[model samples]
Target: MLMDKLREGAQGRGAKIVFWLIILSFSLAGVGSYLNRPADTSPAKVNDQPITAQEFDQAYQSERGRMQQQFGESFAELADNPEYVRQMRQAVLDRLINQLAVDQQAREAKIRIGDQQIKDTIRAMPEFQKDGQFNNELYLNLLSQARLDPNSFSESIRNQLLQQTWASSLTGTDFVLPSEVTLIDKLLQQTRDAQLYTVPVAHFQKTVSVTDAELETYYKANSNQFRSQEQVNVNFVELDAAALAANIKVEDRELRDYYEQHIDQYRTAERRQVAHILISDKDAAVAEKQAETVLTQLKGGADFAALAKEFSSDKLSARNGGELDWFERGVMDPEFEKAAFALSKPGELSAVVKSQFGLHIIKLVGVQPEHERPFDEVKADVLAKLKADKARDLFIDQQQKLSELAFENPDSLDVVSESMGLKLQQSGLMTTSTAKAPFDDAKLKQQAFAENLRDTNANSEVITVGEGKAYVLHILEHKPAMVRPLADVKADVEAAVKLQKAQVEAEKQAATLLSKLNNGEDVSALVKELDVKVESKTGISRTGATLVGTLLNELFRMPHPAADKPVRKLVAMPEGDQVILVLNKVTDTDQPSAAKSMLQTQLAQGRMIASQAALLQQARDAATIEYNPLFNSQPVSE
Candidate 1:
């Protein structure tokens, strides 16, 4: 969906650059240096242009945070998977290298982005605007929330603009051939009808007999698949801010001081409860005349709610007397907000006002003036805030000492746990697939299984489990990988062997049925012999939602059937069922000329994207890249 916005804006250079800025706004680069690693220790280099370790880590952390937010509790399962971590690292590193290559190419080509252009582009962003104009306070607040300083964010924007400019220049103008447009149009208008019958694998299971010798042979060949992963039992000490805050006591004076310092947090913005009778006609004169008539009726003491219900064009609000609900500044149309906020009295009504939405007769129903919360009213909240702040300060100090003590006294976590008032807890045996909290983190799991910890029982350095949480772990027990004996896995192996045999039998039966159908036999006869019903779906497009999975894909792949013969095939379903599909008819509907034009436009945009992708690949292929050995090394606890 974001790609669609980028493609749509790519028509103009300035618009394309602005879209790039919006993209970068969500990246760590746009949010400035959250990672404070030294720039000299580069993790990767693209054509001698180094990508600092800090940049890579910041990007990785940002991506991880995004995934954690998306998946919630399940994110821990993915985080602990070695394959997933490897792929994530490669993806981040590749992105950083690509960016560096693009920047280098842009510089070589003499591409430049002006300061004024950057300023104007940022000001134009809707996120930083209020009341249809740039709001400096809003802009600063947004940057602050993103952890970005103004100067660094602006520089990032400028660099991204330069890269986008180079990309645009390389793509040039994308033109779609008439033949390509015709092909796309034909595909969009194609439809098919098919008859389907399924042969379930369960039916063949009872007929399948797996001998003991066969099961033994299968288990021997696939013994590696049954081997268990290495495991470790860990003893760890954990500290969390929330748990610490629960025991903290806040004095009355502390609460009062916090309340005084953060008074703005308790202040409410001014809001107005306004209602309007809207006459939404495209013709300006007609809408204004209707609004004037409504005003006259209101002045004559006619009920506003009754008139609104009868005449207002805004259907949802008309049912409730045209009530728009409470709103603050910068939320409504410029003309409408001005008229609504200017009415000082509760019963005050504004004259007929013309807005982009047509004409409106506005009434101010009520107002809520800005005010700060009283100390007594917010005392509990203030106390909680003070406690949390104190806990965070205490955690930071304790965490630093804990890290030092854990490293210095590498034999155990006893000293650090006691000094920080933390409890040292033991864990059950954990394998690579362990999804438990704290252990679910890949970095912690890697540390728990490290050779030093497993062989020597050495304590790990302080590891960050999450925000405001850290742990130091030492291995208590180690289990090497081993395969289970045949006797231990005989039942599971027998089931697997029987399932495999059933699949083979089903495929043979499917092939025989297909062969018979290909000859001149009616498909219904075969269905009747199998005692299964055939399902008929008509007028289904390639993208139809009614048919899903492999069956739908098989139907579209079938060629148009002849008058006397239908195309037939066997499709394998995920549930181990085989679908026998007979495509009876294929029809192509004629599209309107407007649809053809739209197709051509889409094809051209797709071509432009492809061209840009090719250029980026070319740049990357030409650039020399080197990665630090530490880049792929095991992660160390922080």
Candidate 2:
């Protein structure tokens, strides 16, 4: 149970603080190398500690899996790009080197995490708890499922704790100076009001016209924008478990056997339809007294729902007369669940039950008996499960065979497709960014366009397209990237050139308007002359989201208006428009005590993070690191 708790806690923590600190530290320190060993055996070394090729490959694969999980099919396409792959490899190596450096430093500092500390950490994790206390059985079961033994998992936790201690000691106190806190508070509380006059590029379009020579020159210079991406057509074969399930046959005996073996899955636990008048408070004495009073009112023949509605602190259920609907054991707090379940008769009220939420007066309103679903009623579901289980087993066998066959006959996919009784599928011409169904995978595209395979016209090795799906393909046709003729994209080029000319005219007009405003001419009067409307917004802050584009940003950047003088500036927008912003007033309000406290906490946390990063960089500079040339020359998988 303790082991299970450790596994559940580890997975929930997800590599922990040390892992992230290492990654962030190395990123800022730059790559370091010590001495190069044989390329085939180790890819990197830190202070003579070799990072084995197997370790590197495993970390690389784990990172790839995480990316695939996060980005889905899109990551496969990203993985195909050489630059993205190179970045991923470098990131993996950086993390390894940084971790080694930190581990060495911790050893030298004699910062050891004791076994008791590891036990305490594991015990504190909420994942392995039942009824607000750690459960030994749950902890062990979780570890068994995660395939981790207690001793090794505990050791890993200990090391992480040691690293965390060393890091925290280096970071020191997260104290912020009084002056810095005051400045941050002032920034957060400051507000500005502005008058905005927008000059749309469309307004200047009529005054701007593109010449034929200008259009032609623009098209020639930006021809790459109109170029078509290189595309390919491929012949491929795909295998998935769902498709294979249709060919699987499950007999009656097999279905019956599966149903009997998994009978517990179909059993329903006893449930109680309960309602409670809860008096929640941090003070147990106050909550218990309130609960006693509510219970006394119920005993005096007062309507439960009416009294509950008036006194219950549980606002959500109070509206419906404190109806919590039906729930089984483990769904509610153990103390509450026990008290509610113990009442056998409907309308029976229990003594005030004390739980984490304070005190509760539980009433049993309805009951549901535990029962197992009849075999005949669930036969269809049982049969489906049996077939699905059989299909999964079959898919494993067939997928392995397919891989072996495809590798043996890499010249073409025809033989493997024929032997596997699968049809050879064809894809329409697709570019590198194609995310269409069936042909949407980037990894598949990368494999199809591999130089070795494309040059030889040979088949690709089997690639996992998605969960439980694999495919192999051979390129049938390839088209090199090319620029479209001037005639083909002349209309697009003309439109783009016209838009650019309009933006230039708009900027020139805005500059002239700013000059007039700077010379003491009122912005509203100038905007009226230009036939543009002036919009006024009050109480805009540094991070206000109402004003679009650079309007809000420009307002904050302008100096505060003195006495009667308003600050003015011309700002460009992303949509080719210009805004003449007039900072009318700046208000500095005093921050509330609660907000000031929160800000102080945030500033302290930021300072600590920065300090930790600096310490990591210092450690890396003191360590000797080296990388093998093989890291650059070899594929990540190799």
Candidate 3:
């Protein structure tokens, strides 16, 4: 179903399927019947094509560019981190392999996409539309905008659909057992009654006074807890991009002249209030002459917009008085723009204009003269330039002093610190798990903990922080990986002990409640008698998420209900408390509806796990998947 729906966006009046088939044929033909070529290049082959380094680089760069908008300067992180790079490369390779497999299958099936279908699919894409309907000129412009060849773009969409279909075929199934259905219904049950109870832990809290001696003892035992990591107190020069932008200047006279010379760039191109009466199946020559006749009528004093409203087949613009809004040159077909722009005067009508869309009569309305930018309009831009220029000057001066202090007296970081009046700021202990500093750009953070930067003392590393600003960091200290001290964890130990006790107590309570329920005692009555809480949930679907604090999953996994024994289940809660749930009743419901809902959720989770497992196996199966020996493969860098 997902594969079928993937075509929905591209189905241009039911023609995309045929179109995609044609595209796939061409792509397959390029492989020249070598779909199963040996995996020789780097031990993995895709669609009979050798997995060349260049191909890898191309995919890598494409992914890199897509990520650039999010990563900015930190795009280097992928390249610097060997594991990250390898993972990304493997993903690309996996996708390529899957694509090849799908293409091979499509080729075998002999699916052929027609020319008309391809055209229709292209027309349906919003990116290639002029206004709402397809225009060939607009389509070409869109391809140019994305720097993609028309055929290549179409082929990409085709391959994506092919892969979707293959993936669905491999994983989608409708062979669910009735037992599975019954099990799901029982799992979905949420029979929540009422929960009422007091936590006795709060009562004990008031009497648990920690003495000064106890606090002292705790502090002494945990003194290693307060013992901070070796943090680098860095002496550095700071530069702000905004400060640079503030001092840069752009002259007003220059702005005014630049605007005047390029006034056409700002000019509002003329638009036509045109309409057409299309004879859809008419001969091209006959339609051309007939359209001329309609143009002649408008020239002979017929109202252009009025005639458009009455007879134009272009319903969208026809209903709006046929007023085509101002569009720039190259936006419309050349023939249409030529005829429309040729009618220079208001109320003047042009001869019938021929385009890919057919023929159209054009009328000129009021002309909107172009306006040039005045010096005053761009004065702020000039001021911004002035600010940036000044900031650059100031930054360069400060950088020179910093460089001299650091390089000349390389023995100590103090020379730069004392002379520049720079405050030595220490960082909190940072690890791969720590959240990145907000002020530190992604590139800076990457470089700070980079393997190349590690163990290098007092070495200055510069990282770009966008807007031409950069950060220069000096590593003063480095700590290798080491075990955490047990003495430094007294508070943690106490908390763990408390939670362990609570869990034991909760388990005892749960077992007691279960025993009473097993002996024919009402669960609600037993809960009330023991002063324990009773929670019930109702009408929960089998596919629905587990409710908080419930043993729903364990309850669902239990053996089916029978006369001999009742289904009992237990689960540990987040707070270390335990829960016991028993399926009180079971019932059957509509299978199709339930199956659809259940499979949707089940299939999603199943697919993710399957995809991951499949990809891992595929990678492992590929021969000699070796890493560069220079890369440290250890989990933790020392």
Candidate maximizing lDDT: 1
Cα-based lDDT at residue 540, candidate 1: 88
Quote the lDDT for 495 in model 2.
Answer: 81
Q: How accurate is candidate 2 locally (lDDT)?
A: 0.80
Report the Cα lDDT for residue 334, model 3.
74
TM-score between candidate 1 and the true structure: 0.60
**Window of ten residues with lowest summed lDDT in model 1:** 30-39
What candidate 3 gets wrong by more than 4 Å, as runs, is 1-62, 68-79, 90-231, 247-282, 306-311, 385-409, 412-440, 446-456, 477-481, 497-509, 521-531, 535-568, 582-638
- Off-target runs (Cα >4 Å) in candidate 1 are 1-112, 123-149, 165-172, 175-183, 228-237, 255-385, 397-431, 447-462, 472-481, 521-533, 591-601, 615-638
Scored against the true structure, residue 278 in model 1 reaches a CA lDDT of 83
- lDDT values for all models: 0.81, 0.80, 0.57
lDDT of 1 by residue, 181-261 (tens): 887788877888888777777767778998889988999999997788898889999988789888888878888989999
Candidate 2 local lDDT, 200-233, one digit each (tens): 8887666677788997899889989999888888
Estimate the TM-score of every prediction.
Answer: 0.60, 0.64, 0.59
TM-score, model 2 to reference: 0.64
